[model samples]
Target: MTILVSGKNGQLGHCLVDRLNFSDLDYISLDKKEMDITKYDETARIIGEIKPRVIINTAAYTDVEKSEIDKKDAILANESGPENLSKICKKIDTPLIHISTDYVFDGRSEIPYKPEDDVNPKSFYGMSKLAGEQRIQENCDSYMIIRTSWLFSEYGKNFLKTMLKISKQKKTIDVICDQIGCPTYAGHLADAILKPIKKISENNFDSGIYHYAGDQECSWFEFTNEIFFVANNLGYIEKIPNLNKILAKDFQAKAKRPNYSVLDSSKFCKAFGVNPSNWKESLPDVIKSAVLA
Candidate 1:
């Protein structure tokens, strides 16, 4: 089997490339230079040429705040890119595994988001991603749109790296306490993606949206504290600073993030027959890899 992955340099994409560890399948990882998925004709042409059995699209305009002012770019990458890829993958009778986000929910509900939950996106980024999901469903037959949240990895820029950087440079930092969600490790999510592929390719599985992430929900404050603790334990920093807790409203941003977008992965676990580890347990290894000794 030939696997084609887009956004090869991204946080999740990079991990997937390094850790997939499959010897039987040939992997073709593409950065922006290899293909600009925003153009439908070019995207379709390249995908049609590759004729991959599985196309996993990880590309996106992921700057949540920037998306507010630059909705066009967000839509182009997140919405149009996936739409084109889905159309081509469907045309070739191939399976498409598209990465989505938990931001599609409006953060109003206290309960964890189900796959069938109504989406009322409060940000341009979320709206664009939701559009991508809709496009895949409309354009494809064999598709797995996986929605994840608060993703971090050893490679690329993410919240964990940001917090580590700040912990080293600053004496004190303020983190939002009101916003609660899971911090999903990219490796776990990437591994989870493969299960569906095997099931779909071998067992003739059903196709739809699935949610996967690190188990356990936490606030930004809680997550940062844990990150610093792990970094200190791993000897990444000489000292850990005081993390001040602040409300979400106090930290103004261009985009409105869901306050509690933690997804219920029961459905995904049942369908895929795999469960993710908790963030606290996953953080130590992540810190060991990304942070210094």
Candidate 2:
């Protein structure tokens, strides 16, 4: 059976491709240039020709701040794109594995969010992603929506790389401490995603929303501190920058982020027999790659 992975240029897409390369799985990974999901004709044509048994959609407009002003682009990529893919998957009788965000929640809850928790997105980017999730559920009979948080990887632009890059140039930096969430490693998330794909291919698929993220939860400040400490020990960085913790309100961002958006992956762990991503354990590899790049 073949798997079609969208967003080959993305962090998650790159990690997915890395895993797929090591495996014996037959798959095709595409970026927007090759398959613009917002274009129904193009998406349908590509998927129809490939005829993949499973479709993993990692393509999304991820800029939270830009989404507020670029509503058209955000909706086209995050909402319309998923809507198109869902319809195509439904028509072709292919199962869809979609990646979602923790931003779907308003971040009012103190406890980690479950798959069945109420969703009230506070940002346009989150709203767009939520719209995509709803579309997939409405249009596709066989689909798994995995809601992940604070994704970082060796590939692409992400928090881990940003921290590493800025630390080298700046003596100090300020990070918001008010917001709290898990920092998931894309490599681990890619592996978590594949476990379900195997189940789906084996006809033991259980469809619905599932939360998968790092096992440890921390504020952005704490995450940054850990990154610096890890990178320093790994000799990737010569010095650790002074990290200042500030409230979210003090930060000038166009988007309103959740104060708390930690996800509960117990459901996913029980179903897939996989543990939540150990982001700290995988930090060394990510740091090494970022430093080398």
Candidate 3:
């Protein structure tokens, strides 16, 4: 059976491509340059030709700040693109595995977000993604929506890389401590994505929204501290910098982030039978490959 993966250039997509390479399954990954997901006719034609049994859609407009100004493009990618894909998937009777974000919540909850919780997205990016989820629920019968948070990996631009670069340049840096969430390694998430692929084929899994993230949670400041810690161990940097804690507002970000966005992924573990990876344990490899190398 063939699986089609969209957004090949993204961090998750890159990791997914790598993970799928070691597998026996036949899969094809596409980036926007190859396939504009917003163009329904073209996407439909491409999928028709491939005739994939499963579609894993990681495609999204992820720029939180840019989405505020570029609502049209963001909405198109996050909302309309998924809907169009879902419609085709529904018609062909192929199951869809869609990647969503923790941004769908406003970040006010003291505890982790459950799938059934009332959603209140504060940003356009969050709203658009939530819209995509709603659209998929409405249009597709067979689907899995996996919501993740603070994703980082060796591939693509992410916080880990930013911290590594900044740490090397500056002896001291400030990181936001107010915003809290788990830093999901894309490689771990890629593995999680595959855990259910076989189950999907066996028809043992049901269509529903699930959360998957790193095992532990922390603020962005703590996450950065861990990055420097790993980086120092990996010998990427001679010394770790002093990281001063600051509030989210102190950081120059256009988008408002949730104060607490840690996702409760117990449901995913219950459903997929795979436990979440510990971010600290997973960081060494990422630091070696991306930061040190």
Candidate 4:
């Protein structure tokens, strides 16, 4: 079975490449440079010719701050791209696995967010992603919308890398404590994505909107402190700096993030039999790989 992985240059896409390299299946990885997913005709012409058995879309405009002003890019990549992929995949009778985000929720609830919960996006980024999800559901029958949050990894720019860089430059950093969400590792999410692909040939293949994130939730301040703790233990840092907790109002971000976007991943675990690891437990390995021992 041929699997086409879009957004090969991204953190999740890079991890998927690492996973697919070891697998026995036939696969092709392409970044936006190779395939502009927003171009319907070009995307349709290319993907229709290939006729992949499965199409996993990881391409997205992820800059939360930039999305506030750069609506064009965000909508093109996050909204139109998925729509194009879904339509082409549907035409070719291929299973489409499109990654989504927890930002789709308003983050108003105290409890963890369920897959079927009402979506009320707070930011332009969230709105764009939610639009993508809706478009996929509307156009494609064989589709899986997997939503994740607080993603970090060894590759590409992300919160983990940003915090580590800050620790090197500053003695203290103020992170928003009020904002709470799960920290999903790219490698883990990449692995979980494949489980569905493995079962795509089966008649009982489950496909729908699913939530998959780290087992536990923490504030950005707490997450940064944990990163320091793990980095110190791994000898990446000479000393653990102070992480001062601050409210969201003080930060003044261009985009509005939810206060609590922790997704309830029970449904994803039940279906795939793949439970995500805790954020704290997974921190050490992430630190070890990115930093020199």
Computed on alpha carbons, the lDDT of every model, listed in order, comes to 0.86, 0.93, 0.90, 0.89
lDDT of 3 by residue, 1-293 (tens): 89999999999999999989999988999999887889999999999999988999999999999999999999999999999999999888889999999999998899999988889998899999999999999998999999999999888788898888888799889889889999899998999989889778545687899999988989988899888877787788898888889988888887887899999999998888888767888888888778543
lDDT of 2 by residue, 1-293 (tens): 99999999999999999999999899999999999999999889999999999999999999899999999999999999999999999898888999999999999999999999999999999999999999999999889999999999988889999988899799989999999999999999999999778777555777899999999999999999899999999888888888888999999999999999999999999998999999999998888887787
Q: Per-residue error at 21 for model 4, in Å?
A: 0.8
Give the per-residue lDDT digits (tens) of candidate 1, residues 1-293: 77888999998788778766554557788999888889888778888788788888999999999999998999999999999988888778888889999999999889889889999999999999999999999999988888999999888889998999898789999999999898899988887877666556542767899888768999999999899888888788789998889999999787889999988888889887889647788888888888652
User: Model 4: per-residue lDDT, tens digit, 1-293?
Assistant: 78999999999999899999998978999989789999999888888777788888999999999999999999999999999998887787888988999999998899999999999999999999999999999998988899999999988999998899889999888999999999999999998888767687332577689999999899998888889988988889997777888999899799999999999999988888898846677788888877642
How many times do residue backbones clash in model 3?
0
Clashes of 2: 0
Candidate number of the best TM-score: 2
Better of 1 and 4 by lDDT: 4
Instruction: State every prediction's TM-score relative to the real structure.
Output: 0.96, 0.98, 0.97, 0.97
For model 3, the superposed segments whose C-alpha errors exceed 4 Å read none
Candidate closer to the true structure by lDDT (higher is better), 2 or 3 = 2
After TM-score superposition, the amount by which residue 181's alpha carbon in candidate 1 deviates from its true location, in angstroms, is: 0.5
| Residue-level lDDT for 188 in candidate 2 | 93
Residue 118 local lDDT, model 3: 81
User: Which residue pairs in candidate 4 have backbone atoms (N, alpha carbon, C) closer than 3 angstroms, thus clashing?
Assistant: none
Looking at model 2, which ten-residue stretch has the lowest summed lDDT?
195-204
Looking at model 1, residue 16 earns an lDDT score of: 79
